[model samples]
Target: MTKFLKTSLGLVAATSLLFSCNEFKVTQETDGSKFQIHEKGDGKTTAKEGDIVTFDLVIKAPNDTVFTDTYKRKEPIVMPVQKGAFKGSFDNALTHLSAGDSATVYVSADSLFMRVQQPLPPGVTKGSDMKFIVKIKSIQTMAEFQKAQEEKKNNEAKVMENYAQKNFPNATKTQYGMYRVVLKEGSGATITAGKSVKVDYTGKLINGTTFDSSVGREPIEFSVGQGAVIPGWEQALMMMKKGEKSIFFIPSNLAYGEQGSGPIPPFSPLIFEMEVIDVK
Candidate 1:
């Protein structure tokens, strides 16, 4: 299952039905899960196994409580359609959708928890149903998805390159695509893998929006090469000596990639002003 779907599962609880069963034609899956098409799409392309699907989702709990709503987030869930993870899984429900189609899927709460190997949340019981309201946004083949991703990456790279040229004219481009400018040199051994270091930093996007900082707070400590931070930070810190201050222009691939972290948009380039305070 995709991240959004997993989040929905964790939030699942017993919920009242939004519609009567007689109102819509329900089709049952091989594993006894069911779905009803609320609106048919005009597109002729139907999703199939191995294709990538983008869809908005809404999971509702009892008393009209929304467990999750992709529409509010403004990003739809995208995943490759595959064989159902279990009988009556969303994988089967997805096969019945086409671009622009809207449907409601009913899945067993108990089966969902069992498949994920997690205990049910409060208010959910052994045989309760979970409701998924989905709107199929698009479907693309694997090749198509890869091509689109490549295009996005290339576009972001160009934007970052321009930003670096204008802002840090003398920045050195690392082999992995990060741009670095040494603001202050320190005399001591440079940081290396397995070394623990404490650093104060302010992180921002390419457009100069500060997302995080450690100026007033105590410096964060982490071990080099321990995967404690983003790849960009790991690489940048390794090149610095204790007390050195540097500015780094990190590309999305080294920062958050396509799945951006909180307050960072996907494919965003990041800027960091960092000072290594201690090394051990």
Candidate 2:
């Protein structure tokens, strides 16, 4: 997760050098860090510690060498605001802005790398500065965020339930809230934890959009109880025997949950048609 944080926060170095830094009067933070606000927001509320923040970020090195830009990726980061690991850290910088504000914060590269316990990248020196360009998109209190998340979860559950009822009314619901319909029963003992299994699967969204499949390719193999796959897949596979073919309706809680992967949307329930070919 530390690596993920580093990447998401745009700590890595990028090859392209773009955007020239313009001169502006710098405001010194209480921690001695400096930032220049390019745009002031009209928001009345300021972000506080423990608040959930959604924002776009761009990290750059000297000479405007881009490290990462969330705006280009079109995925704004959403995270809880916490105290900085050091005086001039990004976390500390966030508290100084409100929704819709745009600012560029400057921090020492040495201190920044030290906080994340990562070695400085090539061409970066100890006393050099790293630039963080941030755009505040939204902020919500913990209670408000939790309430919204609960509402989204409930809505997703209803969607999945409706889809299951309409398509596979006789599907068996699992303890983890997923539904499964066995298409073909396999012979021999049921799969157990630590056993290696080979499977071919086609995964789809509730809207019938296929995201991934193993058709016309080598079947994927993994050991049961290993974290190589989602919890739903492991649970469902454990309930089946060799040669069994089943379709699983996996709820977001048992799958990707709030932070969806690549093409999957947040709070999305997934559908998978799976066949266990071999168990050893």
Candidate 3:
């Protein structure tokens, strides 16, 4: 019968999500590296700087207790092997390692990582031996890596701009030190040089989820181009006619670029449906 053992890491961290794995098979090692690790992966793999690697690895503590193993986590660990990106035992182990090379490198617990890490079971100190199994899925050069990142950024920017135009037909934009909206259609009220307007608006996310609203809640009263709202919004509302419901699709640049609006993360494209209920 192929029966697997149910296991926990040790005496202290019994409730810790960090757990034991099958790969830490406990096959006695003479060196007492204090732990064991194995990989359920293809024999060998390669890696280079700036490359992203996914691997199924197992790690165990000196007392034959398991701390973590990719097998138990049921997910491959994604590591970006770059100078500032990686540090400590894991990074050191990956240094200069190419595709197809398998290692059972032993590391002292203290040397394991150089990051803000959670403390393991009490007494698990530096110099405690640990074992690991690493398999490199692939490698990419710095140029290739940066290119991919830029492409993703560009695509996202394009998507935000495209979505803004589609959702807010009256979304005109110009950057004069500060983002401003120039024109807005469908506002029913006659917008004069100076007018106090009260508007009802429902703002939504790209997915059409409402984030902010003044509909059936309370009427928002403000002067047009008074800088009370976002730049795009200020520009849009100034040209709106009273009694008209206008939809404003605004890009992050004209709205909140890299820094999104309330509850909205960075780079979020905004969609606002507004009605100029009154103009005084």
Candidate 4:
């Protein structure tokens, strides 16, 4: 989101002073912009405009409260450099940093708030100086990133296939790669496209972490062949009949694909224990 982009530029300010410490030299620019270099890094290449920079960050407010910390997630945040639009002193700082560089920068919250329309936290005053401790995890051009992502996805698919063979060898797979195991046969009405089906379901990631369920809540009803649910769910519901129960192992592509929903990561396989309560 743009909030990430704006927060990335919190180090931008217009003017300069210099200070030195045993570990690193700090260059203080006008309006509370401070850049400290910890390691220049051994990588020959530096991040350029349009390149995606992946970094770990921790942002804290003046009240000593944490605002955002990607380190806690154990995943680095990736942001593309857009030079012409939101170009700032931080972008310039990135050009000097290479992969593996670790540094700290300080910027005036007042100056940052002026550039972007954001409400300050209750404890943060107008002129509070925000601190950013960042470590450059990696840098990649858009093309390179895309290629890596494709390779990763293909590897995940292979793992998913192996998992299915081991856990549900008797299950049948659809053309789109969703594997299904029918637990109970239904003698009631058959499900079809354009019919409304009510279902009780529990969904989880391949790692056994439950993401959602309708165990306590009432069963949900939605029309089939509509974009109301994920493609895998829609497809599986169409093959089921009233009172039928089944388990579906959905590949990432048929489920959430590259863009996962809330609490889900990109390219994650899913498991759904489903029951068709009624069909109309």
Question: Against the true structure, whose lDDT is highest?
Answer: 2
For each candidate, what TM-score against the reference? 0.62, 0.63, 0.41, 0.68
Write the number of the candidate with greater TM-score, choosing between 2 and 3.
Answer: 2
Q: Write the per-residue lDDT of candidate 4 for residues 1-280, one digit (tens) a residue.
A: 8997776565342111222344487766542237677776667768888898888877766676877787775556777865422323455556556899887766567766666778876777986766677799889999998887788688886877898899889899888788899999876666878998899999988778788899999998899988899888988987889889999998888888887675566788899999998888
Cα RMSD (angstroms) for every candidate in the order listed: 11.9, 12.7, 12.3, 11.4
Cα lDDT tens digits for candidate 3, 1-280: 2232233334335544235544454433332222233443343444555676655566667666676776554445655775433233555556445554445656656645434465555546565766666555555566665576456446765776666556545545544222223234444446864688888888777786667788779889987766777877776665577777766666665677664544564556677777877888
Q: Over all chains combined, what TM-score does candidate 1 have? A: 0.62
Judged by lDDT relative to the true structure, which candidate is superior, 2 or 4?
2
The lDDT for every candidate, in the order shown, is 0.85, 0.87, 0.59, 0.77
Off by over 4 Å in 1: 1-42, 56-58, 63-76, 85-87, 100-103, 117-119, 135-137, 152-159, 163-176, 181-195, 200-219, 225-231, 239-247, 252-277
What's the lDDT for candidate 3? 0.59
lDDT tens per residue, model 2, 106-193? 9889998887799988767779889999999888999998898778888987888888999999999898899999999999999999
Which sequence of candidate numbers ranks them by TM-score, best first? 4, 2, 1, 3
| Superposition TM-score, candidate 4 onto the true structure | 0.68
Regions of model 4 farther than 4 Å from truth = 1-21, 24-45, 69-76, 84-105, 133-136, 153-157, 183-187, 198-221, 242-245, 258-268, 275-280
Q: Candidate 2 lDDT (Cα, whole model)? A: 0.87
Regions more than 4 Å wrong, model 2: 1-26, 38-42, 63-76, 116-119, 162-195, 200-219, 225-228, 238-247, 256-268, 271-280
The TM-score of candidate 2 is 0.63
Residue range with the least summed lDDT across 10 consecutive positions in model 3: 176-185
lDDT of 1 by residue, 1-280 (tens): 6999877766563222334444467888665658988888875888889999989899864334678898776557888999887778877888877898999888788888889898977666678777899999889999998888778788987888888899999999999889999999977888899999999999997767778999999999989999999999999998899999999999998999987876676788899999999999
Clashing pairs in 1: 15-62
